[model samples]
Target chain A: MTLGEQLTETSDALLELILAAEDIEQKEKLREQFDVITESIEKLVKENVKKNSKEYIAVTHNLNAANQSIKEAIDDLDKIAATIMQVAKVVEMLGKMAAAMP
Target chain B: MIKKITVLTLSLIISGCGLSVTQREAATRFASASTSVGDFSAKEFAAMRDVTIQMNTKDIALGGKAKINDLDGAFDVDDVAIRINAAIALSAYGDLLLALVDDRQSRDLRNATMQFEDSLRGVSGRTLSDADLDNLGALVYNIGGFFLEQQRAKALKQIVLRSKTDVDHLCDLLIQDFNPTGLNLLHAVDNTSKRLKVDADMALAAHKDNPKSKLFAIQAYRLADSQRTRVKKTGAQAIAVLTALKSANAELVNALENNSEFLVDTRLLGVKMKNLGLALKVFSGS
Candidate 1:
């Protein structure tokens, strides 16, 4: 089990023990300790999962590269579309020339 | 001789169009489904932060001791921005994929071809025969569509190959971030909310003698229970969507690698994304 999971299981066990404690002072002491353990788990989890870690930075870089490659592909497709239109324009010119001849 | 050459070229273009029709459909579906996943994640992350802050407020009201540190985690603006930005980048990547394969350009070419055919009728006082006009339309469509499809297939192949590693890593990282068992964001939120629930229960136990105090404690526990449910459900949906995206992307990459026409069955990914959307709408009430 992960540290978070282990800590959580321990915390739950502690809470159950607090419920079972017969002495009021002991119950209060266990509750305070439970609070501390839970907080430590939260802090540890947050520290372990850094949002701006190096891996995330690398992902951002990869996305930039992918975006550039996609942009180039779109540009190339646009040029091909232009060529298709040019072919149509040439065909139209040829038709008009033939019509004007006879 | 020129007529024969023209006929052969048209034949080649039309045949090329047939080759990638299924692949094109697969690329389009992958793009749409993955985009939905990205958009879902970005919204979920922002909502998670808001929910954490709301829970923290309730924590302070319930006399919980760890409010300040938990609230600081929620308010880390730069960290949240990085997470949200990465998700938006993912959405943008999917959009670019769609742009590469969508038929908007070819549709425009069809419109232009019709206009050109209309102009020819007025200028020469000689209307082309219906068959001639039909052939002209078919030729324009096939050539335009073939080139576009061919390029789309090539670009899709290049992109899937080049970006596969990064996409896999990002999706896996997001899944772990939302994982319930790990030392991740979801775990931190779950811990805070669980602590609050415990405090609520203790409050209920402590005020057993006074009716008014008992009523207040009951209401507090209910509030804690409701918010905890929301956080858990939303976190689960985030993980589901990211998991679907990772599998879908890997399937797409594998198809491309094999140089096969059939890419992937996006039905499962589509259903997962739709479910995530429904969960978000219900949880956020918006």
Candidate 2:
């Protein structure tokens, strides 16, 4: 669990213990103080997560590979059929020249 | 010659038939859904920041110890920027997957895989380890390059399988950030709504004697109530979107593994994404 979660759990456990206190006078006073402590703990937990989230997000590398370079490379691949046709034409002309020489 | 033409045509047909129509559709739908989740989260993070500022403003107006100068430091702009970039990166990840199966656009799967390697190299400094790079290289060049060739199904499966761990990690991070239960984005929004309602209640109580002021206060209260409900509903929808995004990737992998038709789930996920988009728009009041 995260530190924030652990703090929250601990705070809840403290609240439970406060609720189960046997001494009535002390229990009431402690509950009031405990409420303030719980509230502070809640805020602390939120801030902790928020601070950690920044670091988490910062390390998230962009996994998107479909950019200008990739698209251009794919576009070049798309011209393969036309390039093959040019190669075929050159080969055909060579065959014709060979026939003429014979 | 004529023989060459016949051989090329036969090969094209066989390659095209490698992935079934249902499989292609499922992959496409999954890509779209994941991309939507990414786009939504990116925008939602900005909205969350705005809501935080508004909450701070309300707290000050309610007689709390804060000033206008404090508003400037109310939010972490750098953190929000990183969140937005991370979300966009996620969308880009989906685009990479779509480019693999999308025959009309990316016919040469080999080049696509290579391009991804080049792109990964560019971003490697930020996060990817050497081991991660080697594994990615192996996945792209060896499994994706050699055995899969240009076969869409096998290539997509390889990409999805290779990306599943990262995808889960990313999704989990986002889920934690947006989870309604914790003191995250949605919780902040909920608190903002409650603060607004408190302001409205104060207005109502203060203006009880003046009829005109009372009318305006009542309107304010109604607006606050409406906003609170909208926030609640949108919070639920946000969770649903994230859940669907994670499940869609997992289900796509499963469908590919079993070679089963999972169109129904994809279609449902698509609709859910659309609904969440609408909900978000309503919540944004844009």
Candidate 3:
């Protein structure tokens, strides 16, 4: 699946989990993370298309190679499709887990 | 038992012998070895020995400017620099013993290591004085002696010695003792995750209906972010702890991102996660 499609699916899975959340406060906080995930994806698909160019892809790839000079470039938020995924994973782990969710 | 007593008694007596017969011998050997370079005399060695002992004993006994001045005298004056360097290490040996002995019982091995390290730095350009560099040799002996006396210091020293080949092995050794002996990484992970659940509950209470509340988001984010940041910092520290002060060989960010201490220090997670809201606060100039 495309990165956007994959992210949307993860978002849906997390939202469905959130809906079952018994704690009203948990529901609200999950709603915020849910909003963050949606907003980040929206930012990617809308305002950041030029950022998805091969130049940005190279930055994330550069991190894997230990190009010491490019550490700052690697930190560029738009360059990190993989990191978005990884952070989504952290959110699922920290904010929502399949095993813990009803 | 008798041998242990003999060894302990001998170590104790040698610790007290002051001026150290062995150090005096080393100074004589150093002087003879370097005579081709200069005629280093026993008097110079004795002068260094006296000054270094007085300086360090005072340093250990009190500490601060008085200590710094004592070393500065040896540092600033000429000709005796080499002898003074060895003497500093020798003098520090007495302090080490005072800390180790039963009544004294202070365990600042790091301080002892640093003093010897300074002496080693000061002596770098010169050969041992005619007295066989007795003071330096005796200092090396005492450092090695602590290997037998203190497990943590010895393990740390060994980690440095062994890190050339197996750095992960060094980290593994740290994991064994960093907590109590039996409670380790696996336990740390399970316990922290469970505790995170409780923190999550608290965050739920604290964050409910408080989207606009600056304090609430900061608290929640800090609670969440601490786990990640602490793990990263300690992983960096473990790598750094092994490295010489000037060197930066440890690319330990990933290890910190991945490790156990991060899990235990979970309070900061909330602080860090608040980064997003804090950034928003800044952008809005609030």
Candidate 4:
């Protein structure tokens, strides 16, 4: 497969994995693994392209687009984390009240 | 009459004219909870605040190398700036709690109670019927207990209000700063990875064509490896921080939910105050 195609496939898979990851640790691991794949793709693109060539500019643009999608996915994950934190705070408060009970 | 006067004078001298040490100690103890409760709340808030500040500082430092000349660096810097702003919000929350604990309201309440106790001593040996003396003692007990309860309720309310505010601020920070920073950091890391991959691939291709390019390819691979390693380290740290924050947030929520127990029953205080009024009425023979 072409580098762009590989990246598109990888990005799709990572997004699905991130969305399905219920555990914070699991999500983080997925993100790290995704980073490795993207890095490899980036290397491939760079190796095959010549400066000012159509292939070079096209791959860069594709990479940028893929990165944007990844950012959106990460943002979704972060939102989930923040929600968890907020819920945790509420639970903590309830616990304190319970402890205070006579 | 002479014998009675002599005994009364001796009793007055022994008890410091009705202001006994025991009475003062009891009164002080009753009011001391005001400060103690405030101190406890402050300590708890500080613990959470410290952890939050540390996380934000780390994020900010991670982005500090971002420069306009370097796309990744510039992006990272902006991400860090968002975290710093969130940290400031967290700091504000901490400050409000500290202020609530250190406020003079508690001290003022204690001093007023002490003065009231001192004044009450003046009525200790007044010429009154047995019924009147009993009423007077009851009045003192009712009023003193009521005062203590009042102070406690006030302290509790302040703590609760401040705590709620802090929680709200935390939520806001998460939305405004934490979420955005996380996205930005991810983007920067992805961008960096892509750049490093390009270099490594280019070097490898060159080496395939010319043996002299082998060293360059090796260096490129090493650099890419280092970049991946850095990402792993940072990812681990971020996870750890978020975990701690999540835990702290949970604790806070539990505390808030159970806050009903901490709430002072002002109605009970009202009853006590009413009893004081009734005791006074009996003493007045009305």
Predicted candidate 4 versus true structure: per-residue lDDT over A27-84, tens digit per residue: 5567677667655544443332222123223333433343344334334433433443
Q: Backbone clashes per model, in order?
A: 0, 0, 39, 30
Q: How much is the lDDT of residue B64 in candidate 4?
A: 19
What TM-scores does chain A show, candidate by candidate in order? 0.73, 0.39, 0.42, 0.45
Model 2: per-residue Cα lDDT over A1-102, one tens digit each: 754355445544544554456554554455455445444544653584567565555436424432333344344434542343344345334434543452
Highest TM-score among the candidates is held by which one? 1
Number of the top lDDT candidate: 1
Clashing residue pairs in candidate 2, if any? none
Q: Point out the worst 10-residue segment of candidate 4 chain B by lDDT.
A: B175-184
Candidate 3 docking quality: incorrect, acceptable, medium or high = incorrect
Instruction: Tell me the docking grade of candidate 4.
Output: incorrect
lDDT of 2 by residue, B240-280 (tens): 77777777777777777776776566677877877887886
- lDDT by residue (tens digit), candidate 3, A1-102: 656445556665655666467776776667566656544553443232232222223322332222221222222311232333343334334322323444
The alpha-carbon deviation from the true structure for residue A50 of candidate 4, after best TM-score superposition, in angstroms, is: 32
lDDT of 1 at B264: 43
Give the TM-score comparing model 1 with the true structure, all chains together.
Answer: 0.86
Q: Residue B242 lDDT in model 1?
A: 76
TM-score of each: 0.86, 0.64, 0.20, 0.33
For residues B49-129, could you state the per-residue lDDT of candidate 3 as single tens digits?
A: 343344333323221112343442222243234323322322232232222222111122333434433443354334334
lDDT of 1 by residue, B169-205 (tens): 8888778677765667667666766766666666666
